[model samples]
Target: MSDNEWPRQLPAPDHGEWHDPPQARGRVLLAAGLVITVLLVAGGVAWQLMSNGSSQPVTQPSAAPVASATQPSVTPCPDPELTVAVAPEMEPVISQAAATLKPAGQRCSAIQVRAEEPGVTVDAEDQPDVWVPSSSAWLRIAADRKHVYQTSGATLGWSPIVLASPAALTAQYAKDGKTAWAGLIQAVTEDRVPVITMPDPLITTTGLLSVHGVHAATALTTKDPGIAQLRALTLRSRLTEAAADPSALIAQMSRQTDAVTASFQVGVFPVVEQQVTIYQKGGYRIPLIASVPVDGQIEADYPFAVRKGVKAGLAEQLRDAISKSAVTAAGFRTQPTAGGARLPDSAAEMLAPVKQWAQFQSLAFQVLLLIDNSGSMNEKIGAGTATKASLLRESGASAAELFNEQTTIGMWYFGAGSVSDPAHTEVVSIGPIAADVGGKSRREALAEKIGAYGPQASAGTPLYQSVLDGIAVMRPKVQAGRPAVVVVLTDGTDGGTRFAMSHQDFLKRLGAAQDPARPVPVIAVGYGPDANMNALQDMAKATGGQAIAARNPADLASAMAKAFLAARSAT
Candidate 1:
């Protein structure tokens, strides 16, 4: 959706009666003032309404579920089937409710939902019959004379966006009780904090909402500094619009060595839940908490509007079913609650509270570091380590530490050779491993194995064949939903498979082998000058993973850590 496509409906201009603070003062003063105003407004409204003995009139249902005559007519039914497009974040709870509705013969299907930035036009022109936007602002933008339906409730609202940090890093702020939105902005703008956010405003509704929340808070406080600082930070943040799915965004955030910060709405529960599961398996501790701004809150309303000329009966029934189910089963409140409910089975449970960092040190991640020891790895580069073996030995050790495993580590190194020649190519399995500097544990163990090779480098890289063999070795140990990442450190291209299949062919087969419900993410680390960066990137991109480049020993550790992070963070 583009800004141009958005319907024009700007908020009324600010009146001079509102204060305008200098941009240098940041958000604190503004936020505090806004908080006071909100409290006053809320209290005054309650008192006035109670005394007047008159209540605010509830707005009539905006529009009825009537079909337009010009559009295709749907058959009228006592109960018409309805489809609701939902963002992936809301999939679990929404789907759960949908599943339960099956006994009623209500056709409830959860379509893949895309969240457009407020004021962006979604291509719902010919897609789902109903569009359930992730936020209230987006709903207002998406609706027109052509598409109008009743809003069930605000799905979730924005909390004061905070920089999610490790407990150690944020302990001071917690102690100072400075975890408010204003505090966060001050910390980030002053370079006192390290935070992360998605890069693109157009793609991530959460990011846009976060910005809007800050803007709204600033507007209430008459503070311009907070807005300016936020704008500056947005420019420097490593956010990118490249992530195509929640899984990709999760993967990218999980891999970061720095503190992770993101703008998330209520719909992100599924992905958050998955993160919690992984952290628990790995024995890492982190708390995920939602922070509400002291000032007026920013809420997201998920609207389900029937397209024009849809069956009125069906639309109405479907809307009723969705409204009833969402309120009862989904973690949504018809109106704001004093505090949000913690999902007992949510990924957010693994998250530490705002400005807190919990150590993720206990569990060890088991990684199968598959190095391409084929002949092409020996190609000389302009400068730097030319051999793939040297690169693997140098890089693999540091990569292992990023996951900080508790037990067994496995390793396999292979080159072009028939299975008959065990000496030429071999698969070596190391400890339920301990972390070592370079060649002791699984990562180092494999590095050592490659070091011992007598340089009988094969003619080609059996990349796909190696991965297949590695997967077989790894498949047994991987727990359901715990990530099983295969970091393929390779040079050149995949060749020398017993079967004449391309890398894509191998990937297709691998994908087929996994349960469609759960798929393993594969990360590719391309090393040395001749490494096929493009091919590796393509492989990683295809699997919703990352393709990183490690040109030298210095870059290898970070790259390896990043690769592991990307792979593990994937939902």
Candidate 2:
């Protein structure tokens, strides 16, 4: 909306007194000279803080333009006017500042901030003189979107990226007085789920940054970031709710545990300090868990970029004035603290892999986990004490429990010893809370069924034929919004079963039987070294799914994650 259309003044923003240093309490150091500066790196990653010291805050002059004592007193002309298309979340602060700004006897230009979504406004027909996105990450993205070779902007508000958790989980962080990014990742890996709310990164900068933030904090240099793979492995593991934007997600997921029922919602997400403060003042109960990583925090540096035809001087004045307002009135950090070093030029290169995470769907779907329980499946997996079937069961249980309840899931066990084998069964029917096994809900029942498979794993794997039948079970229930898929976990390729159809024949039938309108992806999980990764990949790819290989105990979790992640489009 335009400034002219907004209220002359917003009701003084009920915010209490702003803290000069904001809520400063933790530290996570960044490697190299990439000392976590407040800058937007390319590829849409919000590189918030630039500690390299190549320059000062965009609007902060060395000494606020000092006037000599002996200079003659002369009235200056009215300063130029500049329009700021401010991000929706920052509009109140910017507008409030505009109202309180003084003229000093000479109109030092009029500054106006109007709410705008950077993705939309940056390419609008009537462009604002200045663009203030919530994250600097959009500066380059906006420029590139416009097909323009270049666009320049400066950081106006520096709010560090922080991990905000519900108070219920705050105890985990209270001990060390620091946020543990690794701990969160490890918990997800172990199926100790952390409920987090996620926004679509394509639209929200925080959503985009959250994907990168979590991965960067958890990924080691020796390993792949696995951001997508992580999401795949732990589908809905960390998230309990999903929303259109970060704030809405937080507010939606933000709830105190029901003391009477002993039930609580799970969710924590990356939000700026300013947001946390605003929410608190607005009566949100969730508190900051730890605003840290240890090396450094990802600064949420709001950048003020000038579009074509905008006067540079006016843009500069606006950048300075808005930045100053963010600090003095809104509690944002606009400059580096004492002894802070500049971020290295190499930091941009490191941000390359983060782009993929932003495109993640994380949507819920209906799925059936088809486990191969042939006699060969009982073989040991690598040198590990557990057999392939045991590890599969563990991973399956973890994955099933971690998926959000919104997802409809079921399970099936298939063996190759002829189609009439007594062992083959539809353990969990395709439904929510599927026929409570042993008094446990579908999730629990499935877990128990998987965990109990020991000496019972006998007969040949009806891998191909079982999937063909499983698809029949899943296809009829497929709905428009809730995609369906069949995930086949096998330790070996299709063979040895008397009732098994030829691999080629199975593929043709699976292909021809598929209804494009009611797609059901058949994803494959090759559980052991004997499994055929090549054939599995092909079968999965045919149904718009993927085949993941668990070559050993170590790759089991990651492979499962990759397979689950591929399930999004499987149907």
Candidate 3:
């Protein structure tokens, strides 16, 4: 019905009441009453509408909206509280990220960040809801220990492992181009840059990765140069603890004018790239430079691991809130491809070097150096100008430099007389190298003895008898924590005149002398091609020692280093 048109007044109810019987008359009266009521109501509405139109047009009010229980509200749910455990180096960046998550503004989570070492976190009984470790290796370590966590499957930031050194020492090398691990190894080995400190592999992931890098670079070689390098460092006390702060080293390097002295005083260390960035900002006298290994960069890919029970929404929110800009601004590369080298996927493969380093550290040295002064020693080695005896003297002095004050060493040269008649002459009895002997250090006296020794041109080799007599004499002197070793350097087969035991008899006796509780390994060096290597090998195997075949001066020197390392670390 149109609003403007008033309802046509109902046809005037027949106002004339019918003149009929009493019942009919009563119904007619009721009908008339209903008509009169309708007319009165319509007339009243018309009167009100006319009065409102005359004054002003009427406006109707909208119906009130129903309060809904299921509709979404304008305000958001309360922000959740999240606990984050991060690596020590990542603490600052992660803390900055946490502050950006304001509960009152963007409705982000309330993050509680704590700086923790990944090694400690791996074994922790109670873990945080979120964990950001410096390297993904820690995740493998955690999994190996059955510490369950769900990785975000993305790295938050990246920093490659680098060889950190003073810019002054490495200026020429760095200017040449990016240095490889081989170059670093060669430099350290040649004493171009003397001291090289490595963090203890057992204590820090940086140390673990550094050793792994060295191992990977030398994987194809028969014996890693790292072993020899490590042995040298151990003897020289150059391998320092994981006290990585380089302030003292920088100060010492800055003052030294001589390159050799500076090399000895200052050492290069392996650390993450971010540490170099932080160190450079310190404004030290000697600025440190980081050389990324070109063969493969062992990087610290900061993994964002989420615990099982943490809400997925909260975890994702946190991951997104930590922006790429923030990460880069904090000196972290946002991409996983930042490193050139890829680490081993398996946890055990990555941990192999760490185990080897631990073995190297467990050595306590007590060694006997038995040299052959037989006629064969005067023969030239492999067309070289140096004779076997001359090379032996040189290598012996170098090896002697490897022993610290704690090592007990003795020297003996044998080739004359019979086995029962004291054929071998002792140059120095087994004693501490630092001990005073004849008003001079035993080390000095020993050096002098090795330098002056000459070959006995008429003497027989007597190889079997010398080993037997050395073992018999040294076995009783074995101390509890020290490994007692008899290192025999021979160049020919035994020329026995029915006085020395046969090779087979020697092997049997060596095996019979074995004491599982107290082992004394016989590390024998078979020098030159004609040496009795088979005999030496058999005897060495019988006593859990090694037989090294040395063809020339270089081979003898290298092999001797390995033999000494094996002897020191035996058992």
Return the top candidate by lDDT: 3
lDDT of 3 by residue, 1-571 (tens): 1121111111222224334686864454345334433433342223223322534468999899998999788776463478888876677667766666655666555677777777678768877888998887877877888776788957888887887765445632343758656666545333344346776565566776777776556443325353344433332232433444333344344444333233334546777786666555444433466878775468778888988777867667777777778677656778765535567787787776576555554345788888988777888866768788887777666566566545788989878744453557788987887677898778778878888879877677767777877887778877787768899988888774344677778777777777777777899898888888899888888878888888654567677766766776654
Candidate 1 ranges with C-alpha deviation above 4 Å: 1-81, 100-121, 144-163, 172-178, 219-284, 323-330, 337-571
Cα lDDT tens digits, model 2, 1-571, are 2253222222323324534342321211111112211111111112111111225457654656678999899777454377778776677666655655546664454775678766567457766777767776666666555623223544566766677665445433323666655555544333333344566555665555555555555453224333334533343344544444555434443343221111123345667666666555444333434365443345556765676766687556444445475454555676744422122233243234333443335555788888877787677756768676666666565566546545688888877465556435787776774334566567677777767875345577667778888888888988877788888888877766665677788779878888888888878888767887887887887777778887764566567766766776454
User: Which candidate, 2 or 3, has the higher lDDT?
Assistant: 3
Compute each candidate's TM-score over C-alphas: 0.35, 0.63, 0.57
Candidate 3 at residue 33, lDDT?
Answer: 35
Local accuracy of candidate 1 as per-residue lDDT tens digits, 359-450: 11123345576766566665544476555555455444323333332335565555655644431244456455444535444544554565
Pairs that collide in candidate 3 are 297-341
Model 1, poorest ten-residue lDDT window? 352-361
TM-score of 1: 0.35
